[model samples]
Target chain A: MNEIKIFSPATVANVACGFDVLGFCLDSVGDDMVIRKTDKKGIHITKINNFDLPYEAELNVAGVSALAMYDAIDVNFGFEIEIYKNIKPGSGIGSSAASAVGSVFGMNELLGKPFNKIQLTEFAIKGEALASKCEHADNLAPALFGGFTLVKSISPLQILEIPSPDDLYATIIHPQIEIKTSESRAILPKEVPLSDAIAQSANLGSLVHALHTSDYKLISNSLHDVIVEPYRSQLIPHFNEVKLAVLKAGALGTGISGSGPSIFSLSKGEETANKVKDAIEKVYSKTGIDFDIHVSKINVKGVKIIE
Target chain B: MNEIKIFSPATVANVACGFDVLGFCLDSVGDDMVIRKTDKKGIHITKINNFDLPYEAELNVAGVSALAMYDAIDVNFGFEIEIYKNIKPGSGIGSSAASAVGSVFGMNELLGKPFNKIQLTEFAIKGEALASKCEHADNLAPALFGGFTLVKSISPLQILEIPSPDDLYATIIHPQIEIKTSESRAILPKEVPLSDAIAQSANLGSLVHALHTSDYKLISNSLHDVIVEPYRSQLIPHFNEVKLAVLKAGALGTGISGSGPSIFSLSKGEETANKVKDAIEKVYSKTGIDFDIHVSKINVKGVKIIE
Candidate 1:
């Protein structure tokens, strides 16, 4: 009980029409972490492998998130952490979220799960803010609670765990490019046409309904982003071509994953997901951009113990 | 059967955060009509009662909708409709929708329902346009399919019938003032803050989830209209006072129903609905505006046959 090894999965936020509120977990892509109890009185990051991230407790997302949880509890001992990073920073697939959720999840497990999911999400958001420069739970909620999550409200931090369809799979392609969350957010207009807002709400509402009923066709029709995608897609090279190719390959829908550099397509089955992956790969390979593609089922369980 | 008599229920469109896309049917307020087969070649409005509406087929909402449906069919016989209107025009409670739905629903029944709900909605929208100057299926979908409905899209006409909780009830207060839908719509800003749009979408997404799970608290939390209400509420007299009184009376949520003047509050059960009605009535009594209030359960069977 004093030590734990866990795998924290990556997540896709915004989710087309569900901008700033919805996200889902990925199964095949994640980061592994090891946490052990130490008599030292606070959170300490002893090692970080494969990624050159800050080792300072205040600067590292994992360390900062673990510290948030640690400061709230009356534990006599501290925790030591070692992260084996797999999700690259600024890949637009919740890279910081994986690390933030991992540390808090591991710390809670070591402490016999004192805080609930919402509290854990709060702690994670503190660390997530260091990356995005704003507090958002879209990525953190899905990573901590698994499957699909909706940040219904931020002031109260209400997160609704939407049920992912049994056959749902995600195809994600990261082009090894960085789109800083702050810069991506800056490009959006301060105001949007009211007509577009209504359309976006309709799509998001239908998407929620589609998920509840497991209607793939409705999901396909509803995965439209009339509000954010039009502007943000400009930042990602060949975004339109890749989306068109994936849709033609039978993806239910495609959009920029989170902010950019990574694009995601949702398909009904694993086979179709792989087809979508191949389609996107073909499109991206021609662009001569270094890319990583993953086809994974919707991870129903968020962060989990590896050993 | 050559003849059919029906009751087409009134519906509350907008429903707070669901402006332009969501609505629910009401049990008590509606219009009654009798549609019969005729040997003649076209639709005829035989008699009008209680309300002074256009007798000419083309000018009437019921006739316009029925003609739309009749024209699409290859039937030899025409039809005659007798209207017994109870729902007042410009009530903002889908008064036109009730009449429009009644004719098509009765005709569909007479013709053995050759057209499905979507086709019926298509016909209904043609009629609704006469009243609102735009085609929207929010009210018509609920009035046709019963319970709650979301008009996911307009061009392809996607209607999703959301399930209503067994105990859900509605309290409506009509303040006998005219606010034309077109004019009410004109008062809204052409552009809205992007932040408000995101908040509106989040509320709508949560509302859909609340409907699926029968979570009353979530429904209460999600029934906020951030985009439309601020402007539209100004048109209704004593809106703020009535809303405060109803919420204090334990109503789940309250907002301008459809376009204005008439306000709607949703409650978990019939008892609370009646209490909400009483609360609104108390507030409106002092405002010197004549009003009518009705409390009813969610009409799950939208337009129904009485004989």
Candidate 2:
């Protein structure tokens, strides 16, 4: 019997020095997708909303992932998927991840949830690899377990769920700008100085420690992106201005969201988060760019299905 | 009355992926020095032991550090010094760090302990700076704090203590070979691929999480060092043979010790640690290289006064 279902959650990647090793799921914002079991053998996918997305199963990240899932389990079942694509296209907030994860979650449920989170993540990576042509587990982990996740190794993809800090608040602003992930990736240097890599690693260690200990100041001080941000900032409009404004408004730290055009800041409290949102709005308003701001705590719960 | 006292402890740097950001203190093995307060003014570091070390005060790492400490805190005090270098020179067990840390610690004691750990580390870096010409804090922090510590950052030199796993045994083998830190450092690549760096960071993060959760498998997997070790293995004679022996004897992981001719292996139990020690000795004996192996637990207590 074919069953249809949907799931969604927001995700963050390139998490400060973590680059491809770290990601977190945001329960507050995400996209939705429906997977229906079909007697048809081949998997079929349709983009209900975004015309920019491809409908072909091989070309579609979500459709390909559903197909991969069926192949892995050797189940004779097939799926027809409709992606709601609620997360705005090119938002830099892991819109693609939400769709892929949502698809995986839906397909797993339809198949009676035989595979585990690790299996689902592996299936999701096929989708991610298709989109990025690179193996990135950052988005996949959070989509599986929710909360904060550190992808320790990739050959076998060791994933560890990091405990979230209580006072962690994230304020994200989408500036209605577009920068393709591939383009942002192109600007990054192929090689980095050994000294810088060591420093970045140090900060990353401190950041992880701070998260476990709930030391907000340590987390704030450790939120530095030396390699990627330096090069990628040029592509985003008002990068420095937005960062400066957020910091001046009392954000603990600020940086590009994923590949950017979207910016996010970490704050200790709601007051500061609101202040950061207002400050960023002031800058973009002057530039006459449309933007949406979201202020929420670290999403401890990653993905869920609504009845 | 002027009394001079000095202390230094063995240190482990590159605490997992922390590369340069982490270190820890050893309790029993270290160096000690002392100085008599003299009525005369100005600095006069008159002596040094000639055990394969340069005797000149200005050129000697310990003497240069004492000079720096005196300049910063007690310009008016004069002292005649004696050093007992317990940690052998060229052991790849932070021998130079012991001298540097001992001088700063001794000078601080002579000057009524005006500086804290941070100040002491800063002073010790002056000595390390003379040797490496770079102010690296990994060795210095463990020499001062006496437990596992993450260097976190170097500019201001933030030191955070990481939770050491219980039942952790370390087997360190010194192959009686000299691999100068400077030469070993030079062998490393000036730049690494971004993918490599991220992989390293991921392992580092996983290692930390493993420590927190006490996941032995992940810790073993995460002990990999792609940046420094691959390049450095060439400098350490029989590196692969010794590593194979250690793992064959039940070590979780093994690697060259800090710019080394020495190697370290992590074992889960003391019984396995003994096996690792014997295994390492068998390999070194085959090469006809005189070697000393120490099977010790992670030293939680870093520095202490042995009256």
Candidate 3:
């Protein structure tokens, strides 16, 4: 194949109590990219459809990811890529992950799939490291493989695509704002109280079990983030307000999506999802912050060949 | 029913990464109790079994738990009880939990089951508090509900029974030593480093997913306890040596159960469990510590009434 087009989904990391370990892909939000082989022996970004993302192959996640894949290949090949970004950067959703995952996924398909999902995810992490300055697979894992994922460890990159409840809906809103991932991380304390740590551990354990057992009530109770959310929510204008409204409006759980500006609520049905979205929107509307909202199911097929 | 009999199974708490939240019961190891209704209007302990456990109704866990249940019901009915303790107290094997749970369960059966499992767990916690001097349900919840249980919150007493892979086996060895729960607990640091906290959270999230997905490799990768085990292991002889031996013996996971003079290993099959038990025994035998070991499947039926 001379060229390949792929779509990579957006993901919600930190999943409340799960912190750096849990994340899930969203169906409606993503980035689409197309990669084509070129006579040139180096990877390059030919076009970007949205936002003034960097064009330098070494800087941009898509270009850097494609470059990493190219380095892995013994066969000499070069690629030109076009990116159609839909998930916005700095929105707490996995925008950069989509670009990074899409690039490698597209390149792998064009290269006759030499690398498996884990290797591809590793390449995506290198791309993420260039952007975030620290590597994390909470977003990349689910975006690359789809559905809910747990990063068992980061050193060897043990990633597992965990089973999730079938009928769950995610209601997300990205209020127009910018909160750098580094700053969001900086606000966290260097140490957590032992009591809070134990409680957080308990909630996270239950949350993982809830996903596997399809127990919505357990999920609702386990969505609390005692460690990160209490500190990070101050960066978002209406985090707790919107979260309370969403829960009151029938969301099973709600939290800051990844790092902030975007908040998500999970529900059992489409109707409840829409209700949660409206409730969150109701709170954000008073702030007069321009926001984008998406209600989507857990994307089971993460990054896929679109054409 | 004039008389009631019950068996409340032993439990392994903490389960490595889950601290005060997670546990599962054992099939063959437990405490048994019998409660009989009397014309008198108060709870009483008429017989003693296996240990020098207090027999005062207010002092003993069995009597205390039964008393708490009798107080819950408006109708005054006296009860007499007999204890048959098989699990040794202070061995970190939920001996107190079995006694507490057995008492409440036996009384509940005698009362024609007025309370549900949650309420029974609540009464059991009260009994445990009298014995351990702190409120916890890691052991009691699993002993009450069976299989694997996760206590997400303690204040409102939120507990959920998580799915367990059917073929799992637990191999446990209880060395003859006393490590008081209070002493085992007092040694933990008041605060933990952010990195260790995050790693612990990640391991816990993966462990929960492992139990759900039947992913044995994930379970092995996640059984690490960065928060509690390092400090608590010092109180137990041959902790690290026994652990290494169990892992080397093909056990899926091994760790200190509850607070710990006892250690438990989880394996995929009966043969592996036996091998793990023998391996753990080998290390303890060198210490010249008298110990007892049992191998059993996950107890699907937790506390149950007997004829």
Candidate 4:
């Protein structure tokens, strides 16, 4: 195809105790993008709607990722990308990742799938680094591969796609506040107690098992974040109240989505997810913050063709 | 049902990056005990062989565990235990755990299996604390629940039984040197770098997934211990050389078994496991230190009745 229209899904990274290593894709929240081959032999960002994103190929996340993939291939043609941004930037639900994955995903499709998911994730990481100031595949991997993903290692770029339970749903509330990925990262301590580290690993390991077995109670018990959440949650207002409310409202677990400002909860079914959304809305609405709430089934497929 | 003879299998705890949380039961290395019910009141250690252990009900690991179970139950009779010690204490291979687990398991069987594995594990932990000076279930959970286990939480005593790959085998070598668990624990830093902790959790999460999916290569990649091994391996003689030798011999991974002196390697099959055993033997033979090696399949049954 000369041109492609794709729906790039948002993602939740740092998934409670799985900080920096695990993430999952979202179904209902994302960005729509159209990529077209051009006679001009270079990447270009032609238009971006609903957001004032940089049009320069070098400055844009989508462009940077597209260029990363483009430079590595022997393609004779260039591509122009138009982004219809729906997920807001700096909301911690992987807005940049959606754009970053969309560009390379569309380009790879237009180029007859020259690379695997790992390679596509590598390109996405370059673009992600521009936003987070560090390379992490947690968000990028899930966005590209779909479902839940564990980034086993970054140096070798190993990503394992974990099975997402069929009944799993995610409820997210972004409080319309900005929490820069870099600043959110900076607030974390350089060192953590060894006991806390062990506990975090135990929880993450248990969560992986729970996902495989589809045991919701184990998933609920394993969602604690003893390492990063305590520090980053301070950046978000009503974090404690929202968490307690959601848990009480039947969420299997709740935590900061990626960096902060966006809080996400996992539930066994879409009904519980919407109930969790209502709980979160109840708590955040009182603060008079212009927040956005989404109830989504765990997206099993990552980026998909819009047509 | 009034009397019971049991074989309590040994376990390897702190399996690489799963420090303080994970373990697996062994098929061949274990201890045997005969527990008999009597009309006379209170737990008793009637006879001991091959080892000098305290006979007092409260002082012995087995007796302490049996008493812990007995004190909580409204029993009309007491039990007598005869020890047939096989696994040497302080070999870093769950000798105390075998004894502790044997008592509770036998008692539970004789009492019509009233206690669940978690309750039995709790009783075993009380006895284990007598040897290690801290409560941990990494070893006891596997010994009670069988196969691979993750002790997700200690306070609430949560245990998760992980599936063992059918082809998995373990090769353990004990160098006959004493390194107390408390000493090994004391040598570790109270805090670790945030980056290392993240890497550790990633490896552990990957390991759990590997076990579920039966991906041997992923298990090999994820067996790295970035937190505790560096400090504890220093206590073991030629730790680095033995690790290299086993990895080169086609072992999936190798690490200090429980604490030090004894090292364990996991292989995909018994053939590779035997090869790993030869590699360990070759390395330890040059040091002129007396050592013992055992090759065992991953025991799906934790403790069994010796008919």
Candidate 5:
């Protein structure tokens, strides 16, 4: 196959109790990249559609990630890339990660799948670093492996694909606003209090257990953030109101998705997930911010070849 | 049946990265207590067995715990308690939790199971408070529930029974030397660095996921404790040496059991567990501390009636 098309799912990082380690994929929103073999000697971006991301190989998330992968391979390869972006940029839902993962995933497909998912994650994270300023994989790993993923340790690049419950659904409300990734990261506390850190640790442990056990109530109770959210929530308009509305509407948990401008809620069934989406949209609608809502089962297939 | 006997299994709290939230039961070592009905109206300790625990109903872990449960019930009841302690005191394994849990467990059985496991955990924690000066239930919950347990939050007393793989085994080595619980806790820093705290949160999240998914390698990597173990290891002689020996023998993970004095390692299957136990014992035996070693499957039954 000289040409291949792959779709990378959007992901929510931080994931309430998990500050930097937990993330899951969203099925509805993602970015698509189509790679075509080129007679030229190097990777290049031919076009980017419906997104303002740079098309230059060094400047684009997908192009940059593919460049990293291209350099790692012993044989030289050339490709012309076209990106059809759907996951909104700065939505806190891993838009850049989708692009980064898509590039490597699409490149791997074209190269006859030489690298495994983990190695692809490494190349994708390097691509994300070019865009997000940090070589983190919380978002990229989930987008690559599907389901719930944990970047257990970044130094050794340990990415764990956690088993998730069958009935889980993700409801996300993406407000039409932009928050720079660097600015959102700047709002987090550099030093967390000992008490809060311990509480966060316990909560993160419980949240993972809830995901494993499929206990919605435990997930609800564990979906608390006293460290980054309290301060970061100030950046999102109507954050608490939307959270309360979603909880009252029966979401198992709700939190800021990735970095902000988008809020997410988790529920057991699609019907409840739709209700959660409506509730969140209702609150955001009152603020007069144009928002798009997506309710989907957790994207269990992170980045995959599109047939 | 006016008399009843039950044995409460030993527990290992902290579980490396989970500090005050996670624990699991050990199969072999525990405390046994017998409760007999008396024609009186107050709980009393009639026989104090091989251990030096206080016999007064209000002063001892068993007696104090039994007193709390006896006060909660509306019916008039009296009991004579006999303690046959096999788990050593100050072993850093859940010796005190066994007594506290055994007391309430024995009393609850005699009372025809008035309180459920959750309530028993509360009463057992009250009993632990008589000994540990705090009401934390990390060890007590697992001892009551019979598997890996997580105390997600203490505010509303949320305790979750986490699933563990059937093949998990525990290897423990208790040096005859004793370290007071207060002394071990005293050495920990009041505040952890921000970087370490975040790393610990990720480790704990991964650890819980590993337990649920039965990923042994993730369990091994996540067993690192950046907060308490570093501080408390100073109180344990040859701590690093013992850890290296066990890891080299293929133990999945190792850490201070509850506080100090006793160290525990988790491995898959009995053969690996025995090897880890031997590896640990060989290192500690050279110190001439007269250590006791145990290898057993995870006690899936927390406390059970012996008669």
Candidate 6:
């Protein structure tokens, strides 16, 4: 694909109780890219001076995904792709998803946008699968459609756009600590108590209610993780301290974002969001962990090409 | 407590994923009674012809609860209590809860309403403690109040009133076949899969959403039981068949009500409710089990004195 402009946004997936079932996109923390036609039938990836990437298309996840999609549509076009990697890989903030989504989105546009958003999302999952080895829809849904999205089902493929409350604000804190997804996945227990299962279900119901009613209090209370967090939180340093500090500072709720050293807090207003961000930073500083805070409203748009 | 009247209503606890945490009352399917003053104070019990109860007060669950309440107050109010049990005992329909709640409520009123509902509920639990040796609040809350209630914590005692959608309808079917509470409790696995736990949580979230949005379709879709229903349904004859029949007949969802032998179908309107009732009856006939159907709206009003 030549002269193609593409954009992909960051996403948060495996949301606590949602595990493989929920995700949404973030507006500012993502990647932007452009592609141009080349004489060669194969592939070439050119990373911008400030960014880094693989040289061969096959070695690159996003490139492979784009190639696969273009092949399916009989688009025999040689292409040169360039990427601006705004999201860092292994950040637990859907870094790889942005790359994959951008590739498929960009290639589709170059080929006259032959597919709909859903179709592009399907192709995006193929790209993501190359890295994770599992097709998870949580990241793709949000990366494709922005806003708060619920992945109702994956087999038959269903995506529902949850009613996003206007007052919702997200505060994400990246602790600059590394906890590989593989290790995080290893720590989770295969079995859980029946009672715990019930509690989790109850919270899920409450979460949905909070979303529908815009009841921020309920939403905060409901953003708990009984299954994954208990195990994964241990891997994240100062996890409890971070959570306590955030809630104590008036954040409605705090939880590990995706899986990891990075954690997130949800607040109802700008004041609370600011307070929550300050609280998290204070705790991280005590532990001497380098971190950055991103405070923004939920991005309703998933992917957009600026060029 | 001589020359006094006590009233208690039937309750439905565990409201699906809320197991042990949620409960609510039903006005039509509860109890009404009078505990009159008597010169001889040895705790005489009488089962009014119109009401259902054990012949002896000491043997009657409600009577025992009344006696316990009196004992707690440090007064020998040796009294004669008559019960009008509107809820049939051992029907998996909160019959014992009605009696226990009735006794505590009645005695509280006789004692000048000394204890609040919370205290009264604690006293009522003594009655359940007498029967099962395990203190449970599922039945007590609904019998004490009138609508959807949640017993969030037991040790420290915390309760919350949950907002429910107005369009909710419950169609209860009681097959003559009996499934003892103790037996039903025994079959559940002590542990469950973590993934199942997560799925249950999602179902619960969906349920809360349905209630908040008054979306009958979502509520119906979300009424799935992954922990209790899977195990408990096996004990009920034609469980799968009955559920299918009810769903096919226009009910939004169907599951074993509380334990089993009693199945309740959630419907959106009266038309669907009647259809569910008839469908269950048709299934029961094939199983050769006589059954009674109670088609009712979601009970918002919990407990109140008829006198």
RMSD of each: 0.9, 2.9, 1.8, 1.1, 1.8, 4.7
Stretches of candidate 5 above 4 Å error? A74-77
Q: Candidate 4 regions off by >4 Å?
A: none
lDDT (10s digit) by residue, model 6, range A177-292:
77877898889888988767766655655566567768787677677777788888899888899889988998878777777666877788878888898888888888877887
- Across residues B1-307, which tens digit of lDDT does each residue of candidate 6 receive? 3466645665666666556666656544666777665667555676565534566766677767777777777664466667776666667778777777776676566667788888887877877766556887777776676566656446656455566667667788778787877898999998898767766665665555556567777766667777788888898888899889988999888776656567777788778788888888888878777877788776776666556
Question: In model 2, what are the clashing residue pairs, if there are any?
Answer: A146-A302, B5-B106, B6-B106, B21-B151, B146-B302
TM-score, prediction 4 = 0.99
Which sequence of candidate numbers ranks them by DockQ, best first? 4, 1, 3, 5, 2, 6
As for DockQ, the candidate ahead, 5 or 6, is 5
- What is the alpha-carbon RMSD of candidate 1 to the true structure? 0.9
Compared with the true structure, what per-residue lDDT tens digits does model 4 show for residues B146-245? 8999999889988998999999999999998888667897899999999999999999999999999999999999999999999999999999999999
Cα displacement (Å) at residue B101, model 3:
1.1
Selected candidate, larger TM-score, 1 vs 2: 1
Interface RMSD of 3: 1.1
Tell me how many clashing residue pairs each candidate has.
0, 5, 0, 0, 0, 17
How do the residues A1-307 of candidate 2 rate in per-residue lDDT, one tens digit apiece?
3656555777777766667677777756877777787777767885467647888888878877777887777656568888877677678777767767778888888778888888888888888788777877787788778878888766776788888887778888888887887888889999998878877787777778888888888988888899889998899889899989988998988877778777788889888888898998888889888888888777787766664
Model 3 chain A, poorest ten-residue lDDT window?
A69-78
Candidate 1 residues B1-307, lDDT tens each? 9898899999999999998999999999898899999999799999989778998888999999999998898978999999999889999899899988999999999999788888998998888888777888888988999999999888999899888889899999999888877778789999999999999999999999999999999999999999999999999989999999999999999998888778999999889998899898889999888999999899998999997
**Which parts of model 6 are misplaced by more than 4 Å?**
A1-8, A14-18, A24-28, A33-51, A55-82, A102-121, A145-147, A160-166, A286-288, A300-307, B1-28, B33-82, B102-132, B139-167, B304-307
Q: Looking at model 5 chain A, which ten-residue stretch has the lowest summed lDDT?
A: A70-79
**Candidate 1 on A111-137: residue-level lDDT in tens?**
988899999999999999888888998
Root-mean-square deviation of candidate 3: 1.8
Highest DockQ: give the candidate number: 4
For candidate 2, the per-residue lDDT at B276 reads: 92
lDDT against the true structure, each candidate: 0.92, 0.77, 0.87, 0.93, 0.86, 0.73
Residue pairs clashing in model 1 are none
